[model samples]
Target: MIVFLAALLMILGLIGRMVYLMVFDAEYYQKKAEDLHERERKIKAARGEIVDTNGTVLATNRTVCTISVIHSQIKEPEVVIKKLSKCLGMEEAEVRKRVEKVSSMERIKTNVDKETGDKIREMELAGVKVDEDFKRYYPYNELASKVIGFTGGDNQGIIGLEVRYEDYLKGSNGRILTTTDARGIELEGVAEDRVEPVAGKTLQISMDYNIQMYAQQMAEKVMEEKQADKVAILLMNPQNGEILAMVNVPEFDLNEPFTLNQDQEISEKSKEALNQMWRNGCINDTYEPGSTFKIITASACLEERVVSLSDTFSCPGYRIVEDRKIRCHKVGGHGAETFVQGIQNSCNPVFIDIGLRLGTGRFCDYFEQFGLLGKTGVDLPGEAATIMHKEENIGQVELATMSFGQSFQVTPIQMAATVSALINGGKRVTPHFGVRILDKDKETVRELKYDDGKHIVSEETSRTMQALLESVVSEGSGKNAKIEGYHIGGKTATSQTLPRSANKYISSFIGFAPAGNPQILGMCVIYNPQGVYYGGTIAAPVIRDIFDNIFPYLGIEKDVEMQYTN
Candidate 1:
């Protein structure tokens, strides 16, 4: 009787436990069971398209295929390996290794062409699964390659605008769920469940396709003709900070960013070469602005009332400060010239005098106030800051050299932005490319916002500087940049590179059109040209050529009457 009762109690306990599992833990166990039979495959989402202001697609996507394999489902292993190896252009050994692996799902290859992928699909090879994917494609290939950037194998942005705005450019991956048997074989007559991916938002930038193309052609033409180490051109609207075109010559192919353009084998050093090749010199690299920086100095002096356009000055071609005698570009010296003439001649002595008169304290004040001491806060990444001497470290010699756009370094974009502020009604504008974001339906999602410009100079000072710079292009050293019927204001710079003994030099020119009310501001920087390293002779003409072509294309009408005189 006791044994029977004990057995009955044990049976009841077992029954109670069974009841608890069925009622209380049913959902947990049900999910576990579902997971065991469900085979999950990821579906890659399409990246957003990058278009210019005119809706010209600069970066888009091309449909490709990702070929994966389920170990248990694959029959005729040798046949599968052979066909995949040939179709995917991979080694048979590599294909076999992945196919033979005992994994539930393994990616055999990705980015297979649509034609080949369709062919494999028609073969109806068991265990082989082909899913469509998107690959970033640059329609113009090398055009604006550095600015547009490229993606990695994972479809993530690696550099340029691609990386800078990754969150807006990358999409959410989806999943494909299939019911399978214990052996990982898909069960027949069961429809696969799919979670569709959401594509990234479209990016519309301020870059104009035509302007970028024209500028790139001009940059390439000049680089090849001059045999320059590199050439960079930046064009923007001074009134607003919208970048129209930015060209860094030797631009890599956006489709083949990792491969070098040169005919050389890949090596460990190739990584460094690739980094160098990917560099956008206009913003990434910094150099002495030479006379282009004089624009800043003149603006500062004029703003502080330290110098006037009519201020009399004498340049014997060189100025002696403290223990240093810095020679001017014109060794004979510009003698008995007004401040306006000194700027036109780009006489180092005249600027040195004004710099000293402004005093180191005021000079540093203007430097910091002009936004030179910090980044320009551009939307792009890796923008370099100005390299200037510490305030306390700036002695008379330092101050003198800094006066004529020497002894300090700044990026091409920095100078362009600052000069824009100086000439464009004293409002300091932020240079930018990205303008708006759009959804897949082309509906406006968000318009990019920028910091409001701060007043850096008085309007009177800005107007005076504008008229003075116009004279420079019309009658001064920047005469090469002068165009017919246009009031072009500009400055020329020929700065020697570091280790002055090496004799390497950078020639640069910064200019703007319709000087009375400037619209476009452009700068050309040519590094270490083979010969004729004068900014006025080489750099100035490049801008002229680009403007000449772009002006009409942009529908900017030329003034019927001449605005400035020689």
Candidate 2:
């Protein structure tokens, strides 16, 4: 009876103990652990470098230090506060508050420069720690700010290419634990342990540093000249879908990304205005594509075999689509012109007729096939899917406007990728920036793979379109886009903006060089310019400016047969 009673009592005691731990003692034990085992010094990992194709560092890390105070280890609190306050640019009261924090340790300041850190270390204050760390630094300041992006205090990527490849760029953070002596100083060689951090892998991209620089220079010049709200420009290797240079002018400095620089006179439009500055217009903003959209129309008509090169069309300035009339850009109309001539002239009436002949279903199909109905699949964030017409609701007026690059919205990237396909033997390619992933030792690990890009048009159709586009530069609207010795093929587009009413316009030009076998393709977009909104007059010149630098830089030799001095 005594033994059975003892066993029952012991079982009851265990239950009581469990209840105490689960209910009453849980918070207490957790607090004790935090006060003891949890007091650790975090060692921040170095963020990976972002390098251009030429191995020049675009984004890199620089050594900095983080200062912290452990309440239990701090012996002379007053001296600590006074010295740290001056060195870290913190008020004495703020330093005091952190020092008095009941937690195991408190962070006083981070990313302290070496000179200031050395000054603090010279004071030799107790309980204050000066740990080595890294800060993200952009060598070029404002250059490619939108492309390389910036990091938060935690070293996490927050914008641009930084955020897109955050996984590969953010290395694991390490930690160290040490026991404090009676004087509140870390006891040398006593109960110390560390877990070392591995640095992030390097990102090797195809963006040539020089090309990107020149592109930005031209974009800034055009933005200033036109007083446009914004401008977006992109250059690409048409054969492989590699974006050589992409620039959105009025870019902020990655080192000070929060700052805004624009002509807007508002003083207090803070947060919203700041976000607008970060927006990448190349892939985010949409426009009607204007006459530059003629490339798609021409390609579709030729692909469907609905229009022949010898076919002639007479435009008396406007065409009657059902009850409404749509006018061509040339008010007097292009009279009795060949199909190829119609394209070179960018004649709206001629394209409208071709659209009607192809019919609604086939036109929509061809549009979808050209990847106009979707995103360009560029290896970037926030790529917008195209806003397009539904297949079922095609009316005659909609078709007519669409035939001349109206009533449709596509991003600058979408247009660039599509145009790349047009000139690069009709193979649709997904635009990508990253070339390969490299280890810290600069050894290549993974080569980026791209979609082999399906065929949108026959090679013959591509050749035909290339010739027509070449004439657009040589004998038609895009004469200003001609670079001295390069055989450039191009088209100019000036699109009207619609809130169903706005009088604003978006001017753009798309072009390819060495028309015989296009190696490079480029496009530029200028938004809401004040006076002249013609792509031929405005955007074409900007493209020519970029080509002048990019051609020789890329070693695209000047044509001996076609040399014309600049």
Best by TM-score: 1
- Per-residue alpha-carbon lDDT of candidate 2 for residues 45-96, written as tens digits (9 for 90 to 100): 8899999999999999999988988787778888888888888888899889
Models 1 onward score TM values of 0.93, 0.92
Mark the regions of model 2 whose C-alpha exceeds 4 Å error after superposition. 1-35, 180-189, 260-269, 560-566
Candidate 2, TM-score vs. the true structure?
A: 0.92
lDDT of each: 0.91, 0.86
Over 1-566, each residue of candidate 1 has an lDDT whose tens digit, in order, gives 99999999999999999998899999999998898899998888899999999999999999999999889998899999999999899899999999999998899988889999999999999999999999999999999888888999889998899999999989899999999887778999999999999999899999999999988998899999999989999999998899999999989888878775433667778888888999988889999899988899999999899988779998887888888889989988888999999999998999999999999999999999999999888888889888889999999999999999888899999999999999888999999999999998888899999875799999888888888998999999999998897788899999999999999999999999888778899999999998789999999999998888777776667775534311
lDDT of 2 at 246: 85
